[model samples]
Every structure is written in structure tokens, then in C-alpha cells.
Target: MSTFHLKIIAYDKIFYDDEAASVVLPAIDGEVQILTNHEECVVALKTGEVRIGTPKGEMIPAVCGSGFAEVTSDNQVEILVDTIERPEEIDIRRAKEAKERAEERLLQHKSRMEYYRNTTSLARAMARLKEANKYRH
Candidate 1:
């Protein structure tokens, strides 16, 4: 069976380290699935979900921040992200509060820099909320 070693590092933490049959990344262009022996390349990721396909065929979802990834020629993938949050690790209440704060900031008249900062924060909070709620049902 073909498999690849994957390591995801974010915010000074080892988010995930293991071997997987496949992994889907939220690249800037779109989602990209990497399989064993996938062509070596690098990509920029956005604020979205990173799906890992375990050997047991289970798909684990993780919310990740903007960053970049590199797939080595030896079938190893390394992803360096600004932040990462597992659905179970997210504090919904706190995320909601952050979302509210970001929304309020957006509503206020601000300089271009402030607006962009708030917008980024809002996007990050929303991404966390979305991942946390996905499995609620």
C-alpha cells in the first residue's frame, strides 16, 4: 500500500505527524489532494479545512490558517501554518465572542490597515466556527 509521511506544524506546535494514504489541503487555488508519491511541489494554503485520510479510511478535518506547504520528493509532506485548530479543540463560545468583536470592528469606520486586519480576524474566527460546527450534527 502506498502511503506518505505528513507533518503539519502551526503556531509552534506539532499539529499532526503520521503516515496517511492521502491528504487534502485548502490551497489558494482550491483544494488539492496529495497521494503517495505525489509530485514534489509547494503551495500556499488559505483559511480552510485540511482533511487527512487515515490508513483506516477515516477522514479527519482540521481548521488551518494561511501558510505554505512543501511536498518533498521522498513522499513526505510538511505544512507550516499560522494556526491550526481541531474541531474538538475549538471553544465555540470563545470563537463566537471573537467573531462578535471582529464584526463590531468591521462596522466601525477605520483606516485601510485596520479594516484589513479586522477582516482577517473575522475570517479566521469564522473558519474556526465552521469547523467546530461541522460535526455537531
Candidate 2:
């Protein structure tokens, strides 16, 4: 199977740097999949799940915060995001609290920017909780 260099860099650390067969992540329009030798372009990402298919046939799942991805001409994909966490790394209680806080913020009147921020926070928290639940044994 063909593979490409995939590097995922979160704000706190480098999450992944290795060869991958494919990657599916949340783009602004929706989910987008990238394979080896895909057309070079930069894509804006939203808060959602990211599934990486490795060369060894493992599907690695993660939740990611807002950011962008760059597909280079040399068969390399680089993702820079505000945050990324594997399902096992997620703190369910903390995510629930964040979701509640964001929901409370939504109920109050606020500036447009504040509203948007709260919504984004809500989305991120929801995504984290969903991913964590899906992987729970």
C-alpha cells in the first residue's frame, strides 16, 4: 500500500509523526480524506474526530480542535491544531464540565465574538466526549 509522511502537531506537543496510509479529519465544509499523493492544498479544520489509517493497518482515532492542514508536494501531510487527544487521553469529567460551562454561556446574552467562542468551546467539548465514549471498553 502507498503511504505518506503524516505529522500531527498539537499546540502542546507533537502528537504523531510517521507514515500513514490515509487520514480522515473534519474540514470546515465537512470530513475530508487524504491519501498518498493527494493534490497539494491547505485545508481549514474544525473541532471533530480524526481517524488515521497507518501503514500497518491500524486505525488511530483522535479528537482535534480547530486548526489547519497542509498537504505538501513531497507526499507529506502536516497538521497543526490547537489541541489533539486520543480517546484514552481524554478526561471525561473535565469535558463534561466544559460542555456545561459552554452551554451556560450560550444561554446568556453576549457579544458576537463571545458567542462564537462559546459555541466553538461547546463543539470541542462535545467532540471530545463523543470520541471518548466511542472508544470506551
Candidate 3:
């Protein structure tokens, strides 16, 4: 069995740090899975779920804002995002409110920059809501 050092960090805190067997990240193109000794490269992440597989084969689920990840040649994966929230940590009511607020702002016909900001907010909010509700069913 093989593994890699994985670190997930955000502005406020470190979400995770340990050795993992694999990780699945949400990329703009699509979901990407990185295994131990995977290719060394940088990947841009989107507002979606991040799945981590530990050495013991336990799966962890989380959601994060748009960010980037760097994979070192020596089997080190570092993910830096603005914010990361585990499913259990997310406030579903707050996320729903955020989604509604972003939707309302989009309808106001703001400037281009404002539109982009609202759009990003909506995406992030939706992502969080989806993650929070995933285990409910």
C-alpha cells in the first residue's frame, strides 16, 4: 500500500493534515482523483465536494470555496482554499439564506463585477447546501 501527505488549509484554519490513499477534488473541467505518487501538477478547484480517502480507507467529505491545489513530485498534496467546511459543520439555514440573497442580488441588474460576485456567491452557497444535505437522505 502507498500513501501521500495531504494538507487542506484555509484562511482561518487547517481542515485536514495526514496521509491519504486518494483524494477526489472538484476541478473546473470535472472531478479529479489523485492517488499516491500521482503526477505533479497544479489544479484549480471549483465550488464543489472534496472527497478524501485515508490510509485506513475511511472516506471524508467536505466542501470548499474556489481555490487551487499543488501536488509535489514527492507525493505531497497541498490544497489552499478561502474557506472549507465539513458537512457536519455547515449551517444549512445560513446557506439557504445566502443562496436566496445571492439570487435576489442577481435579479437587481447590477454592474458586471457585481453580477460576477453574486454568481460566485450563488455557486458557493448552492455547493454548501448540497454538501450539508448529502448525508440526510
Q: If scored against the real structure, what TM-score would every candidate get?
A: 0.94, 0.98, 0.97
Q: Please report, in order, the local distance difference test score of every candidate based on alpha carbons.
A: 0.93, 0.98, 0.94
lDDT for model 3, please: 0.94
Question: Which parts of model 1 have CA positions greater than 4 angstroms off?
Answer: none
RMSD of candidates 1 onward, in order: 1.2, 0.7, 0.8
> By the lDDT metric, which is better: model 2 or model 3?
2
Tens digits of per-residue lDDT for model 2, 51-134: 999999999999999999999999999999999999999999999999999999999979999999999999999999999999
Report how far off residue 33 is in candidate 1 (Å): 1.0
Q: List runs of model 2 lying over 4 Å from the truth.
A: none
Residues forming the 10-long window of minimal summed lDDT in candidate 1: 128-137
In model 1, what lDDT does residue 66 have?
94
Q: What value does the lDDT take at residue 115 in candidate 1?
A: 97
